[model samples]
Target: MLLARIIKSIVIIIFSCILLKIIQYLLKKLFEFTKFDTRYEKTLCSVLSSISYYIIFVVSLILILREFNIVDVTTFGTLVTGASIVGLIAGVASQSILKDIFNGFFILFEKQIQVGDFIVINEEFRGSVEEIGIRSTSLRDWDLKRITISNGNITSIRNFSKNKMRVVSHVRVSYEEDPMKVIESLEEVCSIMNDKFDEYLLKNSEGKSISEFKVYGVTDIEKNPVGAQYTITGVVESYRYFSASKEVKLQILIVFKKNDIKIAYPTHINVLHYDNDYKNEL
Candidate 1:
């Protein structure tokens, strides 16, 4: 009976470990096959794996203890007590940690945003999502600094990177030029820029989703220039290039320079000397 019990114990242990591995592997693969974002999928995989592991470990322990002759009311009670203590510690530590995990999980599972999402949180931090972990999310700030934020603190999320990003360039031309001609030329310039930028290499939010680019017209204005410049608001699409918005703006400047279209600028004029005929001093 002793030998039989030992053999049974060995089989149970081996089976438990194998079961854990299989569960983990399968969970990972299931998410991998979905159309969901990789970061969210990966986070989900880890979370499920961790929970499953603990449950399996606890169950295996109970079974192992039962197989031993030492299994009794006192022994079982002791085991339960020990498990509760460990659980309490973990639970306390995991409160904050779990909030983060929940936030991250909801962000992805609920389709709020993904790893490659270009999001602005609290109207302050704007960047591409570099990583989505259980506790915090990592983002590369505008200055290329890595910013890690707790998921629980994410109050407002502006997902501008998920879809197409609009690049608006308000170009002002001299009123001396024909409004129609300049508008047409500006449109053509924008088209050329769009085509050129199509070939310009750009990085994705997650460094995974690579794309060429697309442009669209937002609006235009041939209205009162502060002095003599007509404002033309040309909005274009730089989808998947929010991170490269700066670069897109630079290209617009280059186009303006090459085309000799003066960009809008505010200026104040002061008449130094009175040139107009005026009575000496009344």
Candidate 2:
């Protein structure tokens, strides 16, 4: 009887495995058919996959326990009843986990953050969100270090991947250069950028690329030993921001050189008038 029961349990476990696989396959097909595109959809799919595994594991455990006569319906009911009290205490003790879960749900539903988004949390942890679970969110920082933060602990978030990002650049010119001419040159650079890198620029509300680039001329004036600073601001696609900024800066430098615009640089000089007088007296 013991041997037969063992064999039966083995068969049941195998069957459970097959069933779980089938369920997972069906779920995969369903998700594929639904056509998930956004980060939110992908995150939801990951969560659902985890939940389905848990449900299947629990069901299989229950069935296996029943086969071994470890638990009956009456005993299971009693256990569940007793567990409720324990669960209440555990819930109180794990309040942070509960908070994390609540906050995670809010993050998903409200669309505040999502996977693949470059975000900074609490003004300290900056990274691209790799995954968001019920209790914590995973991030990969600029240095490729993995960081995990509890959802409840995320006090602030700065998402850089959403929409177009404003690129603010500064170019310093020597005091001798005409600000008006520099502004014109900068505007020409912006126009050239708009035409040359049109793919990298983003469109405005009117569904046109006309406003994609802007040359806000001479926004800032700084007293530097080298020169005066002029700020140039514009908007571009967030994904290509780094490359776009690099190219823009390079182009600005080239344009300034071509136009004989001298960039500000610090100059130091030393004079020895006393030494010259002593030599003349000698």
Among the numbered candidates, top TM-score falls to 2
The sequence of per-residue lDDT tens digits that candidate 2 reaches over residues 47-163 is 666566667766766566666665454686845754565477667867887898798889878888877888889999999888777778889998999999998998889988887
- Residue-level lDDT of model 1, residues 3-60, one tens digit each, is 8888888998999999999998898778867997675676566556657877888787
lDDT accuracy of residue 210 in candidate 2: 40
Question: What's the true lDDT of residue 50 in model 2?
Answer: 52
Clash pairs, candidate 2, are none
Question: TM-scores of all models?
Answer: 0.53, 0.74
- Highest-scoring model, lDDT: 2
User: Clashing residue pairs in candidate 1, if any?
Assistant: none
